[model samples]
Target chain A: MSGLILDFEKPIYELERQIDEMRNFAVTENIGALNEEIQRLEKKLARLRENIYADLTRWQRVQIARHPDRPHTLDYIAGMMTDFVELHGDRAFGDDKAMVAGMAKLDGMPVMVIGHQKGSDTKENLMRNFGMAGPEGYRKALRIVKLAEKFEMPVLAFIDTPGAYPGAGAEERGQADAIARVIYEMGRLTVPIIVTVIGEGGSGGALGIGVGDRVLMMENAWYTTITPEACSTILWKDQEKAAARKTDCAEALRLTAADLLELGVIDGIVEEPLGGAHHDFSAANQALKTAISESFAEITSTPIDTLILERIDKFSNMGVYDVVPADPV
Target chain B: MSWFKKPNSGPKKGDGDRRNIPEGLWIKCDKCDAILFKEDLDRGFRVCSKCGFHFKIGHQKYLSILLDEGSFEERETELRTTDPLQFKEKQNYPDHIKNYQKRSGLTEAVITGKGAIDGRLVSVAIHDPSFIAGSMGSVVGEKIARAIRRSIELRCPLIIISTAGGARMQEGILSLMQMAKTAIWLTRLSEAKLPYISLLTNPTMAGVMASYASLGDFTLAEPGAMIGFTGPRVIEQTIRATLPEGFQTAEFFYERGFVDQVIPRPELKETISRILSYFPDQSMSPESAEEGV
Candidate 1:
């Protein structure tokens, strides 16, 4: 209902609403072709929705990245992955829930899936802290990443969040140290890694599980060094200005999937339906499947060492540019 | 109300109270004989610019100077005291908490946030010495844990600026528990492959120094900063003899290979920036000349 809040399922909702209206009208009138017309309209609506979501603006794409209806880590595990067995605790402290990581099957091949997940409603969000992981979350994700390496499984990470929770309790738990460890470990990881930015990939929160052989972004997703709101606040010192300049912030931050791809921050983009993934879950899932499969197939072709070396090389080259001043006439 | 009230001590000529003149309140710098205004001394990041004598800095000022401009967003703003143990050895826990909160203007000793230094995103946690001598308490531990997790989530480097007077006695064993809690998170971070940098400021000792603070990919200390698990006085007392000169100073630690570098405040940001740039996708030699190796 809010202007900035996008309705990802608009097209589907509209189509369904129209179908209900049409059926109600048919019950009152003796229109013989109404049934046939409704059927045709439904088919047309489905295809049109896909066409609309195929390409989106950077800001629009950011909306999809944080879409509540999109599949989270649990949804992905339930749908595409199988044989998941979650490991618990860092053995040093208690388990943290902001991160859900475990060993799972991807097309019958073993892989580690680690991701940030925000709950559906208020209570769940409070418990998950809107998917802003704390120190324990990072530790949990690290545990799974290490386990994957020990078992020789590929790593798949789904990124979605504003940033890590800046709570006092988290700091006492050594949040910064835990994050540092994860980055260092991933940099030296020998296994193939596939990272996908499914939603709001904000700063270190996204980066925690982001290092991989192939980093992909959903067509309607975003990734950035900091949240737009945070950026705006720091730059303007005015929360109102930050809220007003959300679109501009998204553009400047280069958070969109397309932008990231062009900037070499991401290897590829997974297309969604016309109005976004929420419009047609099946089609979106299929696109994700194909992209993941093709990428895995390509990377898995080489020896594990070679694959890891290539991945490291790929990441190393990112954001590296030699500046050449213009020659004086 | 009258525009001017009568003086409580009755009208007096000149009111010759030299104490009200705001003068002669200077702390002589041990390194330099310069007598500086207490306010000016406090403003110089607790360091004497003339002789470069490092003084103790409060936590907030330390974090501000350490982070890039406009990058900090204080975390855990509210979670305050609960008096878990009702400690009352020297002073009641509640009164101590109130006094600390009033003096430090902070809910806890540790302040955590997301910051950027040289455009490299980092999650920072700093312990405030002003708050009960920067004691490690439950809230401090919680803030540090959160900061670490945030860094891991952001995939940014993590830095903890430590300056503690050991553990918080008020919380008793609960304070010591933070050491294990922090270490566990550090282990998890290590497994995740992120960089953790620890900057030891003035006077990092006791439980905090021994725990996660010592575990860093690159450990740096400010010039003349005191950094050790045990205080020099304790060691000297135990041995019943005087300790070596500059026993726990940053230079001593550096000389002993415990610290990577003893950097100045002005160069701290540049040093961190260079370190971050070194780890970018390129595989440059660790001994690259650009980093002053």
Candidate 2:
């Protein structure tokens, strides 16, 4: 009720609330007929929600990716991982809470899981800085990535953030150096890495952990250098007017999961349920698991030296281009 | 022309030097409208304390502030332009060049040199916005390429403080060629594993910001510096709208993830030194190294 609830989530939340109320009524009154009616209503609601979400615009998808009810990095770990032993501070400074990372078991195979997690509630959001990491968070992620390499474990990063924090303290803590170190280290890492953008993959905050052997994005997620609001504000000084032009902003920012896939910015997109992940998180989690498995299978089977070289080549070729004459001779 | 009888005592004896001086020697701060002594203004890194207006810095002053004292050796010093295009519109290319030379006393927009910042050797190239608005042309590209090569050969970092108004139109395709040329050198520098730091100064735009400036291992900018591929004015014109507050400013880019850091001028030296420390110290004296224990 307090934080932003994406447009699509309102109807889903309402339907869920109704279902809960009906189940409580049936338990209290011993009304078996009411239970049957509730089941039929739930099925009808699910179909309606699916139809509405199936034709979402890029902007609508961006909103869903940032839905407050959606899963964060910690939620994913809680659901899918076993034996998650979180590593602590960056050694240079204090620990960063924005990034949750550690060694964990993915179906009994040891791997490192790291990601930006925006807290669901106000107090936790303050602690996490709304998932925007400072220099320390990136350094922590880098530390675990290096450790993952040493232990011959694959690294899986779940990206979700608007961008790195741009506060004075972040700058003082060598934010740029931390990010550069990660980029350099990730490029040379001998172990396999599979990165997925589960939500808003905004700029360097995303890039700080986004580079890997394979980069995947959720079907409804968005990844871009800047958010639509920021882009709109930049192109038009009127913030209020910009807020009203969300569709144009979305088009200009090229933040859709499909756009990123076409631009070669991401390797693949994991499908989400018709309405959204919030409506069917289990299905979304399964899709993510399958995507990670396929990526790991392809990367882990490659020779270590060759894998490292390929990783280097992968980053080196990013944004590389040759401009030919549009009109041929 | 009433000759001085001690300036004819326009004020009382205890009026404390209240003389209405002529306004030619004073310049107003663009941000705060505070009039300051031109000389004192120059000493404050051209930034006004009251409103923090970043006055245009010349190529020499930029070098003096960035490079270690007495460590700069100028490169391409004798290379002067002869107006290869001989182009003219509202102003002739040769005439504009001559006017800039007379006003700024520089042969080209950029000055390339080898210098030490805190005793760590680096090849420093600075673009002077005063020189034809720091437009990138054939000479700017050539200077940057030479500096990159020198840095790679010497195994030192390459630091470029860029303040450009995009590629020069007079050079036409040649100006665009600079983007590819500089990018190639930057890629080579990357391959060599040498650090290439691009310091975006006020108003880095178009071809410059899109190419080598954006390709830094750690891209940094001065506070309030504007760095973008297209100017806000052009973008606004294309979109038929007004741009955002602080659009293209260093802070905006920092938030948008285009910049690594937005440092103030006073802290720049210390920050750069700290970053240099991440690399192995390469400052051992030649004599001491030769007589190894």
Candidate 3:
């Protein structure tokens, strides 16, 4: 957090550093008069934080969402669930570390939890493929979700991926086929599903486990069909402005949590800490836990068939279009 | 209909080879680079006779190539794409859509309707790649959704010829959600036990590939089609290395057990018709295909 201050957050951090210095000086030099100065600076810091956090642009929110200190799927799982039993492998292939799936007790209720897992460091990121799952990862997710359906347990999927891995191996092993199977099966799965975008929900990788009765996103999460950089490159090959227009591309994509909610893409947003989920992990975890619990409480009581029907209806009614008339027969 | 008609005249006596071929009479194959007569190519269903390269034909040509003459009654032709994200680059999203619409002579990327193959009634949705790369947006999603529902209602076999660059960039999340939307409707189609033949053409990628395009009962592909979740350029950028040849091609997918078969263009209609013959309908046969023998 100290090392990775964003450009907009420099002023707030400088104020905070000044207050810390004043407090240290007062304690060392027996200068009690500095308390008033420290308090005044603290107030200014609070106001600055509020102003910056409240008016964060879509691109800034994307930065916060991608902050290295930001909590990952495993963090939320460890903080919120109990009696976790980790499952592994897609049966036909080796286990994929990028996607974590297993049985866990969510507030004493039996549930199957699955999520895309990114890493905290370079070595672990390499191991996790930066949370961009390959074909096996999606296949493993499908297996776990299918198991949940068989066991009549509610499925909680944490989506946090930049996108599926765009590699030769992923393509060779049928990345599209695996993802398509998951979406196809999950659409009609009898068990209840609640998907929450914990970080970055990018394209079909997220949608592989994203179709749920209640699709949610954390406050800072940005979900999109393609990342802004990719979008900018594709839309504006003008080389010079492609880098500059990346922020505009993010805004144009309408990928923020609030934007998605407004667009009716996501069901609701779970609030994060003032700065972001990374600043206060406990508060972020608590908010996510409450959101999941509340969504489960609302959906768990519905009959399975009705739940399945409503889930299908929820996705079926998502696109915006119009029908005027068919061709003359 | 116009393309189906033979050219009123033939090519001139002089052959120009690669340097100066007559523009309208001769066409070059993208794969083989062999000069081909337009009439011969059209007569072969756009499959190059020299090298057997399957050219990406328009959806109208696909309708004529697959469906029986005068048997197609197009449905959901009026569905239109809205600029949900208000996306703009050099041009406004709606204006770009209008440009593609005007150039491709299509209201949207795909055309959904009921058509006949070998006199077998079938529901079909053919994608035209010339229209915005046949990107899937809200309109394409709704039309395909309606097509699936119509198939279930009519209890006819469904055929969706997919040729897309995946989800539309202009529509953003709405375009992405169309994957799940189409997948959900496809699941409903499967539950109805109606056979779905997803015919993959050149350049199917990303969102569309990860949804309805890959969920077909008989997932067929035209020869040498590029079918994958991510395109080669993106994969090359991601991996930061040169790709092995034949990656994500139809033959590559077939080797990997994803594609059931890679049929040539000339035999596509016969292949689909032969497959449809196996499942007439539930009403026609008391024992549905879903029930195990």
Candidate 4:
């Protein structure tokens, strides 16, 4: 954990801090009374945490979604997959660091694992473009997804990105085309595809690999069409005001996992630990692994001819009121 | 609302070209300083006669310009915005919807349906930037998706003329979900061997450009249109560097082979008709409307 505390989490942080100090004192001095106090404080801290996290506003969830300790794609792959051999480059262009895709085995089922990996620090964020994949990154994903199609492996996408890299080079190389192409090709794939929104799901960057049979979001994650800051800028028409108005925008956007689930934007909300997925990596991984397998079990049983159609229907069903009659096509 | 502002509303002298001058009906051209007569401008498809500056037209205007006489039948027009988020900023999203609906006489940004271009029936969806900056929402996404599905069902070609800022802000993530959803339907169109002609008008930026708008089998753009995933100024600011002239224009995209062709507004109808002729309907007109149908 970052040990950094949000404003709302200040009380919990202080309680936990005292518990840690008392534990250290108990171990160092062989004290029994302080140990008992530490246990009581721990229980209080857990209750406080549960109370606080159960009802976070959309803005607070956004903060947690972007927490540095939130498990990155590389961490999940290393901790969750087996025999993961990362195959690189789009072949038409150079390899992109932001999007890391490769072949892997998930619970004895071979699948193409792809995800947007963000960096932990300034240096790494620069290297990874803050998890914003450029055109080459998407092209590389397309190349590997095509490979997965050839090998008949189910695809798993771990979505976490602020957006597609908005650099000039990315645009020049046709970032739009690359993202559109991936969604297009993947939409037609016969094999089962599952997407897990482990963190921020921003715009087309997330949708680059977001189209699938079943899509899930972590409890603390926020998925939106645009960042709250961007939304504020658009609505208020002032750059400085956007920063100040982001909380209102965040609340207005309905981007929290709970909101998205109710809106029919996400199929499921994967449970994160009370402190968020960052606090309990083991529990988070186990939950993700279970979600993946359960999703796979549901989709993998469908006949080949109906799989692509069902995938189409899954996305087609999510939206406002249907104009056409509910009669089957 | 600014257009309704009286430009020459001061006390008028009787002999000052006031004869049928049509008071409160003049607009200054953004490109040229000359004031234009609103009627004359509308007659010219909203293009500046002197400087050739193309004004952004509404989706209904596009339908009238591109489709054959009395041939357009819009589908799913009842799929109105539910404002699922109940988002409010300067005003609530429902008020914004009410205001735009009153102003534009349209429920949403997109108008999708069937129309015949040069005797060839095609599925059509034209996005109006005036309605919420043509931002994609769940309603817009669902309409476009159904449009593609209609094309698949009718075994006809599909065309979507996009002029958008990006995804709708009020509807939030549901707006962004439209990107994947629209692209999903287009893939279905392609898989079924239906052709999609993506027509990008001025300022197709962000999510719309990054999704179905860029995935067309044949992508066409209006000349001088800004067609990119991000605004050029934004990219320049991020990189802290000056960009080349005409960086994100349709011509720039043409050079990169991202856009198939950049057709001028005046020629758009003719160009689309020519393309529609290429995929002839075997049931009608024997040899198809080959050249200028």
DockQ for all candidate structures vs. native: 0.03, 0.05, 0.59, 0.46
User: Per-residue lDDT for B63-119 in model 3, tens only?
Assistant: 888998987877776666777777876579889877776665678888888867777
Fnat, model 4, is: 0.68
Which runs in model 1 stand beyond 4 Å of their true positions? A1-19, A33-55, A324-329, B1-218, B221-293
Ranking by TM-score: 3, 4, 2, 1
Considering the two chains of model 2, state its CAPRI-style docking category: incorrect
Considering TM-score, which of the candidate structures 1 and 2 is the better prediction for this target? 2
> Cα miss at B87, model 4 (Å)?
1.7
Predicted model with the maximum lDDT: 3
Q: At residue B253, what lDDT does model 2 achieve?
A: 75
Arranged by DockQ, best first: 3, 4, 2, 1
Q: Decide which is better by DockQ, 1 or 2.
A: 2
Between candidates 2 and 4, the lDDT winner: 4
| Candidate 1, B1-293: lDDT as tens digits | 33222223222111111111123346555556565565776566556768887655665566567776776666556446556544443356788777666655666678787666766667788876667767787777767777887766666778899888766645533454455456556655776788888898877765677566777889999888776644565456445677777766778767756678888886777788788776542222223223311
Residue B81, candidate 3: Cα error in Å is: 1.3
Q: Pick by TM-score: which candidate is best? A: 3
Q: Can you write out model 3's per-residue Cα lDDT over A17-84, one digit (the tens) per residue?
A: 88888899999999999998888888889999999999999899889888888999889889999998
Specify the highest-DockQ model's number.
3
Candidate 1 is graded, for docking, as incorrect
Score every model by TM-score: 0.57, 0.60, 0.93, 0.90
Worst 10 residues of 4 chain A by lDDT: A320-329
